[model samples]
Target: MRVLIVEDHEELAHTVAAGLRREGMAVDVALDGHTGLERASVNDYDVVVLDRDLPGLHGDEVCGRLAAGDRPARVLMLTAAGTIDDRVSGLGIGADDYLPKPFAFAELVARIRALARRTRPALPPVLVHGGLRLDPSTRVATRDGHRLMLSPKEFAVLELLLSARGAVVSAEQLLERGWDEFADPFTQTVKVTVSRLRRKLGDPPLIETVPQAGYRI
Candidate 1:
């Protein structure tokens, strides 16, 4: 999943972003609330990790603005203030879930996943197109009942394609969702990952290239 992290704490934000990246999720960080709001306005993210106490805009205002905006993504409010009133107020402003600070990384990951699942259109956890089956939670891909091992990047690319199913996914879209903003489009990284995934899948070319467009499953 693609996520935006809005936190002023540099070290904590970096640690959370790194951990999420290791879990096969694309992440972007904003050090202050103003930048975070700006980033959220333009980017299409599946989830946003927002801090309640912010510099320019308080986390509640941020959530309210996002709710009122053209595109509203799932918000998981994070705060050092762990109180019943705080949680209620955060949710009242439009947060999907409220997570307190000093949380376990595992719990954070689980909550993010839950928030994504809740916001996404109802669909089976096991996504399938043709002979391929992908479990997003487990990061596992299987073809004809046989499990296929994939590197982290490979798994991410495959997940993007499979989630879109028959719809074409542009290289830009893949880059936005499967990789961080720093990824270079001209590096052929997506292509290399796709090639590796194809080799492991061993099928009648489940992925189809959309000439001048991108790739589709």
Candidate 2:
């Protein structure tokens, strides 16, 4: 999944971004709310982790604008305050969920994944096709009962392709969702990842490439 973190705490923002990236998510960090909004405007994200207190623009206003805008990214508001009133106000503004400071990293990851599920049509928690099985929660993949060791990018590409349910997914879509903003559009990242994934899947190739189209499972 793609996530935008709008936190003024530079260290915190980068730290969280790195963690999320390790979880196989495409993450972008914005040091302030205005940059957050600008990043959100151009990129499609599954979730936005917004800090309540921000510079340039307040997180509350950012959430409000996002709620009113055309994009459909779920917002998870964060603050140092942990009170009934604080949470109610944050949700009242537009946050889909609220997290207080000093929260467990596991809970944050869980909440982000839960919010991401609401973004598009629901799919099975564990995706299965043929003899292939993938569990997002466990970050495990197996083919014909044999385990497949995949890199973060390869796993993400496979997950996205499997989630398509036989529909053609363009390279651009893969790049947008499987990679962060730093990825060059002209790069062969998607192709390379897919090629690696196919090799790992072994014989009886599952991914099909369409000339001038994209790829499908």
Candidate 3:
């Protein structure tokens, strides 16, 4: 999933970003609230890890604006304050979840995944279509009972295509959902990834590309 972290603590933010990346998540960091708001506005994020104490803009204001927007990313507010009142206040501003500072890394990851699940329609744990089967929790993919060694991007692209249930998935949509903010929009990265994915999936050409449209299975 793609996530945005808005934190004033640079070290903590980078640490979290690295850990999340290692966990197969696309992450972006914003040092303060203003940058966070700007980044959040530009991208389609599944979750936002926002710090309550910010420099440029208050966290509450940031949360409020996002919550009121047309398509708001799920907000997970973070605060050092662990009081009931504190969480209540954060939720008052429309945060989907609240995490007090000094939280467990595992819990944070779990919460983020849970929130991301809410963004998309309910999907089965194992996504299967014909000979293709993918177990997301295990990060495993198989075609006709044979294993496929897919890179992170390739795996993400295939999972997205499979999840579309044969509906056309545009190149732009794949770029947004499969890559992080650092990905250059003008780059041919998406095309390259899809090409690699098609090779990996192999014979009979399962993926169909429609000219000027997109890809479908």
Candidate 4:
């Protein structure tokens, strides 16, 4: 999943971004609300980790604007205020969920994933096709009861393909979702990752390449 974190605390923002990246999510950081809104406008994110108190424009306005916008990205508001009123206000302003500051990193990750899942029609918590199974939460994949070792990138690519449920996923879409903004658009990273994933999937070749289109499973 792709996420945009709008938090003024540079250290915390980057730390959260790194953790989310390790979880196989493409993440972008914005130090203030204006930049956050701009980034959100430019990218198709699955979720936005918005800080409730921002420097300019304020997080409330950002959340309200995003709620009014056409983009479907879910919003998970964050704040140092932990009162029930604070959470209710955050949700009233359009947040899908709220997390107070000094929260557990694991809870933040889980909340982000949960919000991302709600962005579209819900899928099974554990993805499966035939004898192949992938537990995203555990970062484990198995085929016919045999485990498959996969790199982070390879796992991300496979997840996207499987999430599509057999729809053709273009290379550009894969790169946009699997990689962050810094990725080189002209590179063959997607091709290489897909190739490695196919090799690891083994036997009965699951991923299919559509000429000039992209890949599917």
- The per-model lDDT (C-alpha) reads 0.85, 0.92, 0.88, 0.92
Q: Clashes in model 2: which pairs?
A: none
Query: Which residue ranges in model 1 land beyond 4 Å of their true spot?
Result: none
**Candidate 4 residue pairs that clash:** none
Q: Best TM-score goes to which candidate?
A: 4
TM-score to true structure, per model: 0.92, 0.96, 0.90, 0.97
> Candidate 3: which stretches are off by over 4 Å?
none
State the lDDT at 131 in candidate 4.
91
Give per-residue CA lDDT, model 2, range 64-147, as digits (tens): 999999997999999999999999999999899999997888899999988877846877778899999988777899999999
User: Higher lDDT: candidate 3 or 4?
Assistant: 4
Where does the lowest 10-residue lDDT sum fall in candidate 3?
116-125
Q: Which stretch of 10 consecutive residues in model 4 shows the poorest summed lDDT?
A: 115-124
Model 1 residue 213 lDDT score: 96
Q: Over the stretch 1-217, how does candidate 3's per-residue lDDT look in tens digits?
A: 6789999999999999998887777899999999999999989888999999897799999999999996648999999999999999999999999999999998998888778767457667688988999876667999999999988888888888887889999999888988887788899998999999999999978999989989988
Stretches of candidate 2 off by over 4 Å are: none
Candidate 1 backbone collisions, by pair: none
